[model samples]
Target: MNKKILISLATSAVLISSIYADTTSLGEITVTTATKTEKSIDGVTASVVVVTQEEIEKTGASTLDKILEKIPSINAQYARFPHPSSKSKASISLRGVGANGTLILIDGKRLSGETESPYEMTRITASMIERIEIVKGSMSTLYGSDAIGGVINIITKKIDKNETTIDIKYGSNGDGEAKNKNVNFITRAKVGTFKYKIYGNINDTTPYSISKSYSQVATNPSTGSAITTDAQHGVTGVSNVTYRDESTTKTIGTRFENDFSDNLKVGIDVNYFKENREGEYIGTAKYINSGTPILVKNTPVSSEDKNSRLDVSLDLEYFITEKLSLDTNIYRSYYKKRNYTNPINFTGPTNTKFSANVTIDGIESNLKYELNDLNFITSGIEYRKEKRESSAINPDPSSSEFITKVVKYKALFIQDEIVLNDTLNATIGARYDNISNADNKTTFQAGLVQKLGENTSLRANYAQGYRAPDIAELYVVSPSYKDGKRFGAEVIYGPKTTAYDLKPEESQTFELSLSNKYNDLSSQLTLFNTTVKDKIELVSYNDGTAAKYYTSENLDEVVIKGIEASFSYIFNDSFDLSLDATYLKTKDKSTGNELMYTPNISASIGANYQITKEFSSNLNFRYIGKQFTNSTNTTKANNYNLVDLGARYNINKHLQFYAGIDNIFDKKIEEELGTNVGRYFYTGIRVSF
Candidate 1:
């Protein structure tokens, strides 16, 4: 079916359901990420989405990516086998912007490691989270960099009474391949003035081969057409790659808080995570035949990847006076990764190794003052230092050497909130940042919210955002080699030269939204536009050899604009439904082409039905429109649909059971787009005390 038809059907369903719906308001929910202060959803001018603990449990998702992909205007991509050479990691992007444009936080603090790395999200399990707040649009006025797209803040749970919970789950594909197991536990207790929480989790998955369900498709040189074949050798598109890698992930964390009188409170948090993966693939090898080099296909290659992270933080809250208060956070994070590849019969080295280590330290303080009944002011200062040591570009294989880089930055920001009247509110903010080895930057933002009626409100916002060049883009001196598929050819990437004179990418964003809640129906519509300049892009040159050399360079401008709509209706006490859709258009002015991977249309519909007080079920459907995979727009990934169903049964307050199936129709897309691990079934049990 066409995208228009599907969208129309979804809209009709929402409208039809609203006619007979009867429910109560969701009540006031406060969010802190939008303004760095507690504000109700209706009061925040930005486009925001909040996933509560109840909603999180209903999804039956074990990882962060699964939960985020269902959100409107958010695009998520996953890799079956993550590898350093491939530079492929599971990622989530806001609007049509890339993953690097988004900022992720845990309890308002940035995660440790490469700012662009999405692996950090994978380490966060669903069991420990109490809620998630997603604020869309340019946020650089409050956050200095990497906030052009938006920000996601994860809030952990806090218990007032002593409690302990344990959960276990297992899942596998219908064909009995790619099995997975997960176990997690959380315990919390409260004393007279102190509170603590402890949690741990372990997850493992077994690898499987794609050949079981897919066949190799090679291009016919004579006719320029694609042909499916079963040949094991001399083929361009080998289907012998591992569909999923054998992997194991572990996590442990603890939180402690103390209240010393009504004026002061202190808290400490510590978290640790570790992951390991192993996989094998059939690739190519070079051999000498009759004094000529011959490329042989179907060569066996093995790889191993390992990653670990540690985080420690201290938080302080104090009230200097009744109208003034101060909040502070001090944090340190460490991350490391190591990868090894061994090709059985290759021409060069027998083994290749790559490793990276990152350390970050940061401190931030904020003070809020109520100048008068209608005016409020907030100001903050932040300082951060990051250091990275990596052998990613060390050209030598036998020598264990690495290149180290350090970055330090300081920032100051202030914001004012003004209430013009009972029906209108306004906010303005600005920030200035100074970096050690980069140009200084300053950003500004303004927003206004006006009530149209008792049940409707209108909001408008404007902001400026920027992103600084990372260490590898500015300081790498050596070359790194990787064999990959690009533009339908087996290509090799040589060294990526550094560009010391690269400037920061800058953007301007404008947004307008209308929201309304009437009876049992709630709806919202938003329009947004973003224009970016001095964009940093990797430009490649094909040397006479088979290698493509690259350099980071400032490119021309690009523009992205989109429309988003969402509706929810409660049919009765036992049934509720939601529908959302997004339409996007992006263009690179220099090339007059749409941005790669930016789909024009995407939508979702979800419904929940409570069969009884002890049993509940949910069904969800997702659709993604066709998208281009290359800058030239020659290759495309066709549209696909997904359906998921889950149910929960509560035997008592202390014990519960849940089961679910994902990709019920077994929809599959091109391998280049992402892995579609066919139909999967999972069941789990939870016990609480």
Candidate 2:
């Protein structure tokens, strides 16, 4: 629709809005991700789920993954990577899509990480988060890349009062055993015209071992493939192994801001995150004999790692006029990761070392204008530059150990909103992105929302998706060094990813949803589907010699369809219940096969009971249906279910005590090569002043 027509429609709606505007409740949650400006959730045509502070506190969970797992639409799973790196750690998936497809943000800024997974979950505590706004659909028109699955915007705590808090917790796998521990400190105060807030958190957790020894390993009866020992060691049959991994995270952050005048404000924020991880993985020798299956003989690899990241940001805002405002942000992030691995009684490389460093710098400026009470417009420009350096020292020094990659990106985006009628709204947006490595492209989105009555509303949207190639996928080089000159050994080179050889992934996504809010019950149902072309996948190529290398290549197509349903009932101030479920169907149309690591069915149900204001209890249950781990569908990750229980008590205003048990039934599942943790218990206390 054109601007003139949209404005006229909104003007008519404003006139009619006077008839029944006072009959509805005035309280509505304001969201920023859907419109890039604070507005009521009902004013947007997108689907958004808000995890409020009250919800976070009642979950009794310390980690973001555990807290999000109870949401029906989230496919939250964390695993140990077969190939170790800073990026191979904990991750979160949505709607059965891979974690890499989802874009995660903190306070409207990018949180840098490996393209494979997000490893920053343990750095921040739940107490540091004020709320999380989840936008479930394509948002490429606003955010440049990696928005095919969805967007998660985490809003951190902003202190409204001078306060200090101390939180501590201890956890275990079973009775009288220690497994996890956490401690956090937070404080905020106002001095003169400046306000400041600081936070510190420390988390430590022991390892979880799926199997005790190689003797306990066996083959899969369904796929006719080995389960425990094959995917880990690249061996076919034998089982002779033991596995253990542990992690520790330490984080500290501070935010300082001041208002120079009533029309302008400035702020500076900084954070540091450090993590230590170590693990031992054992497997059998390679299977060369011509037999049905091989055997494992207890050969293993042990590794230890140290990773750290630093983030610094500056914010500026000014009121250019009464109807116009400017917002600008600049951020820089640096990541340093190093690891050492050694083979034990194996016929592989010995004393191998791998290290990587990534640096990212970004800047963005946005201008918002309110044309009238029913019209809002926003325009922004963003630029980002990233550099990656990876090095490895193998048992053979001549194999080469260095690779560097760099990328520069810029984007321009604009969005318009109009209140077409008292019960109707419309949104139109577009973005143009330029990448140093590939052809520039433009994307667009349009949506509509209509309120049928005080209790019902409908939403529909169509959007475009875009994703640039990852650093590991392109611009990689391995120059074999013998006396710092070209040697006899073959040098591995990444395949040049041209617009045709490896085209940028393009997708079209659509969603339709209905929501209802009654006296005591609220429900939402959404149907979504997406079609993608030129899907990217890692492919191996021979360097026309003994050496082999890998690069990403474009696949034919992919189709995904899914349904999400959620409902909540508040019986009173003392009792509340919620249930949600998701069913997904996805396929790699080129191969006529289901996508990997996507479950067909998943759901979560929970209830909260409060006997009094200071005493409360909560119970939650989650289930994940069967899924495949391999492209051929020969390997499987069996279905699993888990239950959790928690309770909290307050002795007075300054003292509180809480306890929680995760995986209450001791449920365990062998995902691919590693296993999920067992039952864990924790107790803690909080003090606030």
Candidate 3:
């Protein structure tokens, strides 16, 4: 469909909805991520999106990534090609800010491990989440590093009555490739004054090769011709070149809360996750020897990766007076990963083993004071320490190993929310962070919301954000290699290094949004602009050798601007509709080129209908516009559309059955882009007690 047509249709829907708008209230929706304090959605000044549990169930999504991709301004990449030997991880870029710029939190606490990796997006099951709150634009004033893009806070369920649920699902592609099975169980109960919830999940998926859909070919460097036989260019056909690895994941967690007295309450949370992956690849390599190019057949390589994470946190809330309260949290998290690969005839390493361990400990306390009816103040102090250790073992004793790195930081922040009048509200906040290894930094944010009428409001915000370099980006010492680098032969480069004087990336963002809620119609339109300085990027350079190696560097500047619009309307009790779309433009100022993998347009349309009290069905359509695959904008991935159909049937109060088909059209994109995995069908049953 044409972009103009889509935009016109969306605009028409909003106008139509307003014409038929009634007086029914949509009810008050409260969110805490915007201000770190509970406030109605209309009162919050930030651009926020809330996904409720009912909405989650309607999608029939098992993983968090599957559900988040439908939201506007969020681009999610899952199970893509050209991955490392380790298991595939899902990542998201908010408004083209890059994956590493976003911060993810569970219950308002950061997770341990590499901040760049959004593994939780895939590991956390949808059944365990009560709701998810997404706040767009720079949020460094509330959260610390990695908030340059935005913040995603996942809130888990807290049951008020005894309940238990069991869910089982099975899925497979049209050709029976990539078979998957999942099982989940959750139980919540109360013992005297203590309430607790326990949950567990297990998922397994088989590997599938894309060789049937795409083939790999080698080119002779001297003749500049395609080579099909080993005798022609000493190259053999590749096996499993484009394949998805086999993986198994398991998770278990528990949450406990108690009110010891009327003035005090305490809570504890613990969670553990583990994943294992297996993969194999066979190919050939060519190299130069004695000033002559030589092609060689390489031995096949197999790899195994094991990863685990553990997290524990304690929370306390105390009431000191009628208008004063205190909240404190202490938490600890640990992540470990091990990777092993079989010996190979080519490349740099044989019988390689790599391992990494990351640990984080933190404590925070906040005091909330209701200064008066018009103004509220919140102040907090935080202390956090991070440690990382990584090592690699190869048959060659000369290989370099990664060194351990530790960083500690202390922070102080305060915010004030003032209700100037019944129709206007203002918020101002600032944070000062002192780091042990880097320069101290301070950030600020200001926002205002003004009611234009009884059903319309306008909001504007400005914020500063920054991201400090992590251990892997600043201290990594590992060998790097590239395929088909020199005359079609793999090049084994020396260990990659980073400069000790690397500076943090900083950004300034501005956003404005107009929102209206009238009767059964709700709509919002937002515009955002962000300018970043000293953007960290990996660049390749030749160190006077034939081989090319990569190092971390800071670019001069980058600019990203985007517009987002969303609308929803309830026609009646039996049917509803929703539409959302985003248009983005991003550029690297130094290179004068658009950023890679940032799409120009994306949109989704959804409809839900109820045939009966026990039967309901939904249809969703998603469209992703063309995107460039490289920074130079030489290669492009064409636009694609996906259609999903889902239905649910409730047999009784204790049993429910649901089924869904995703990617109904079975669209596929270029291999340089991500794989679409074609059409998939899944069914599941939920039992409650």
lDDT of each: 0.74, 0.70, 0.75
Question: Candidate 3, residues 1-689: lDDT per residue as tens digits?
Answer: 55566557656655654454444433599999999999998888888889999999888878787789778678864322112332244568888887778788888998886546645666778888899999988888888777888999989887678999998988888999877788999999998889999999998888766542213333443332344553334434444532556888899999999999888999999999999877765433344444544333233456677889999999999999989999999999999977665523344243332466888899999999999999899999999998877653221212335446689989999999999998899999999988887788999999999877677778999999988876545544333222322110012223222233567889999998877778878887777899999887655565553334344567789998887888888899999999889888888998988877778898999999998999999999998888886657888888888899999999999999999999888877565454657898999999999
For model 1, how does the per-residue alpha-carbon lDDT over 1-689 read when each residue is reduced to its tens digit?
A: 45466456555544553443333333388888999999888888888889998888888877787688777678864431123223234566788776667888999988866446656555678888899999888788888877888998888888677999898988888998778788999999999899999999998888766652222223222221232342323333333456566888999999999999899999999999899977766543333444533333335556677888899999999999999999999999998878666654444333333567889899999999999999889999999998888764443323447767788989999999889999899999999988886789999999999877676678999999888877655544222222222110111122223223677889999998877666777877778999989776544455443334345566689898887878888899999999888888888899888877777788889999999999999999998888876667888888888999999999999999999998898988676665667998989999999
> Which candidate number has the best TM-score?
3
Better of 1 and 3 by lDDT: 3
> Can you tell me which runs of candidate 1 are displaced by over 4 Å?
1-27, 77-88, 211-239, 281-300, 346-353, 395-400, 475-500, 543-546, 549-551
Q: Sort by TM-score, best first: what order? A: 3, 1, 2
Clashing pairs in 3: 286-489
Q: What is the lDDT of residue 540 in candidate 3?
A: 53
Candidate 3: 10-residue stretch with minimal lDDT: 484-493
* Model 2 agreement with the true structure over 147-264: per-residue lDDT tens digits: 7667888898885779999989887777433367888888998887799999998988776543333332233311213455453333333322223347788889999999899899
Could you give the C-alpha RMSD of every candidate to the true structure, in order shown?
5.6, 8.7, 5.0
Sorting all predicted structures by lDDT, with the top scorer first, yields: 3, 1, 2
Clashing pairs in 2: 214-240, 214-241, 238-294, 238-295, 238-296, 239-296
Instruction: Return the clash pairs for model 1, or none.
Output: none
